[model samples]
Target: MLVLSLAIWAVKAQGGTFNYTQPDIDSGKALQDLSRIAKENALKRLSSSSSGCTADNVYFLLFHRVYIWIFEEKLRTTSMGGNGEKVNGSQGMLPGGTGGGCIKEGPFSNYTVNLGPLTARDPLAHNPRCLKRNLNTEICRASASLKNTTEVMLESPNIELFQANLQGDFRYPESRKWGFSVHGGGHFIIAGDPGSDFYFSDVAGTLTMMNRPPSRNGTLDDVLDLEPLGEAYTLGEMLDTVGGSPFCFVYE
Candidate 1:
């Protein structure tokens, strides 16, 4: 009997058998409850702020984290390979030990979240072990050159850019879920226009506010103006040529 017990333990340790068990459903409920409380606090802060600037910033930050969490939980239930599907929580594992993003584009042109290799420059610069020599040259070049072309600014956790009430029935274009709110400010950056429908190559972080004018498509003038933030300039120095007229800049 002792020998049989030892053998079973050894096999289990060697991953020959799954330790079948149910997840703690109560823990899941607790997470949802926490999320609700956070939302309420964010709304109160946003509503009472003297300058809407700070409130809008806080709202977005909280919403972003909460939305990402909600999306991830939904994915775990509907998709395979979550944190522990094989041995509980192991399903979240990727080849390189990196987790997955909750928001992603789908296979059939619909946006479905996916787990893939890191394509950004900051991650590659911070951790070179993740990059492979035999990988595609284009991908490598893109990652390496990202810092030169991209600007990233982190928002403070205290600010909320979006409130929970703003989540009602709003959808981002070609996205999987509701539109993002403003508060926990976004990572402000000036990014290159890499053949996007939005603007010219020189324009940095120009978003389309409304209907696209047909005549302006594929032209330098089509893009919305990118202005300089006098304070907290995170992206590379604002180029003079791209600055255009001061009237081009839009303040949120």
Candidate 2:
């Protein structure tokens, strides 16, 4: 069941923590626990000098248990194999797993990704290929440990520091400087040919910001261009998640 009681203790020492377990997932107690814990911790904050509830306090262990359960407990295959449709070349083995290529079974077995593995020219050009995943627990253990995520979340004070530590900035590439960000850990949790390249890497944007001219520090006056998604708005109007103009929601 992987209770991780030790992990829970460690996180408690830090500030908060996620105590993931298989039974919690199977019995569906995890979601209920989140709602209940958040309410309790929020009330605790309301009456005390403690800081507000954060991700660690609200929902711990949900991602680890549920994600792993999907791949290891239910699906039961490390690799999502390929169907025998004719192909140009091999999908090849993903970084951490034994030999693997296209998905052959499951509901998403027939699904195909139509885009570049984008390490190629015309990256945005349409090119259909079978869905593939190289799920590896070893990779998760090496990169996404409780200590790794906890440090990134709690230790860093500012958004820039948090983002860099969580994303593993190249500016400071020492293992002693930071743990590989959980963002990378989570990405590789779904690791594969294209999974590695799956959405544009945020690290590049962070790098761009690091090297930009002065006055690049974002301000409320900053413009957010949603374009086709929505009209543009000043960053100030968007900061207040609950009452901000063009935005209305409160995080739980």
Candidate 3:
């Protein structure tokens, strides 16, 4: 809750006027408006860009993400044991989250999350709790359709446009358009408490390394520093996902 609140606060701090109160979400044109903003702004940027490329290696990631969350897990015959980083998860203090609450049985049944819900009470305090879940199919079908994913992958030419489209930035909207972020759709695949919360968002890719604009052009020398997790790498080193040190698997 604390962390999520801070995120919302940050959005407001940036002069972004979004309907943060989560209006009767079932009936709101604002979200629809946001969809248009992301599409137009992204398309405009792509057209004006000079270094845009349509190479296959540029942006091929599509429904593979959905497959990972849904099918990949199903393919795992063994139980997901405690082998990765451990943390205690918590709820967003929602008034009885629809669908369900803390997971009772499963690999994460014994799992606990700490240091989250970053709020005014204790920004980084170690508040441990169980994980909560709420799968939402409505959002997945409406916003994260194949059409949106295709647009985001093929329509966007520059990194900025891709970023905007992938985020569905509604901070600036005009009329209407049919579009939404595949990234946002993935997040909503498990929407309810923490799932819907704006805790974190990130991505990767090869042709996506270049940040081209009128002012400057991004180069492979640029550094990607994921401090606290691992050493940084140059933009060039991250090009290959299968034949590299940091990564060793190819998308099937």
Candidate 4:
């Protein structure tokens, strides 16, 4: 068993701020520590939060970002021997695999995700189980480069254009316009099947509602005026952006 410092498992930090940073995959121990902390916090939040932590209530990007931010802070504090200083890094994406198969590596390998089966009438009431992932390199891979992300952002000056580009048809890979399509690709790649939170359904619709800025006129200009699009971001920065946005409070 990996022997971790007692401070690593200390109570979650409250109202503290830290510089955004990515997860260090270079250290398997650090990766494992981060994943373990993430899983624990995920479960705790699911059990205690007002929304019960279901996909239906907690928006995917916002909730997961908050989850990851919490994980990042804990990991940083532990790795630095509990100094509690600002850390720099982002969440590590799951490495690519050959074909569709269970996720067998990373800190989340053995971790159990307690709140899921989005189909369950009351998913939170279900028992905890090992986190499940179906990685598919064929359809989704690390090939999504920063260039592509930048290009998409550049093309999508406003929310309407961004949404239109993102809702591309999946039949032809090349036809996946941008934004949402790429977003879906990441989800499919990371969570390939029915078990994934990204699995298409009403849950995705909920996420869309959660992500979109409220609009009265329902025009791109209005929405952009409300929340302007910015540069591409790492997973950590993305989470921070979403968590700090007005959308975070919109969920309740």
User: Which model scores highest in TM-score?
Assistant: 3
CA lDDT of every candidate: 0.26, 0.49, 0.46, 0.40
TM per prediction: 0.19, 0.41, 0.44, 0.36
Query: Measured by C-alpha RMSD in angstroms, how accurate is candidate 3?
Result: 12.9
- Score candidate 1 by TM-score against the native: 0.19
- Candidate 3 lDDT (Cα, 0 to 1): 0.46
Rank all candidate structures by their TM-score, best first, as comma-separated numbers. Answer: 3, 2, 4, 1
Model 1, span 134-238: residue lDDT tens = 112232232223331222112212212122212212442322122222210111111111122112211211111121111222222222211221122111222
Question: What's the distance in Å from true for residue 195, model 4?
Answer: 1.7
lDDT of 2 by residue, 1-252 (tens): 112222232234447656658888678576445434443454454443232222222111222232333445344544544333233444345344532466667566777776555466755456788777656566577677887778777877776676678668777543236544676777766655553234333321222233322333444564543233244455566566567665455533
Q: What local lDDT score does residue 188 receive in model 1, on the 0 to 100 scale?
A: 12
lDDT of 4 by residue, 1-252 (tens): 111211122212322222223443344455345434544454465554433332223233333444444546567655412111222333236443333333455555555555445456754344676545544554453334455445655677676555444545345444365533555665555543344334423332432254332423221111111011222223333333447432233211
Global fold similarity of model 2 (TM-score): 0.41
**Which has the higher TM-score value, candidate number 3 or candidate number 4?**
3
Candidate 2: segments with Cα more than 4 A from true spot: 1-100, 103-128, 135-147, 158-160, 170-177, 195-215, 225-233, 245-252
RMSD of candidate 4 to the truth, in angstroms, is: 17.6
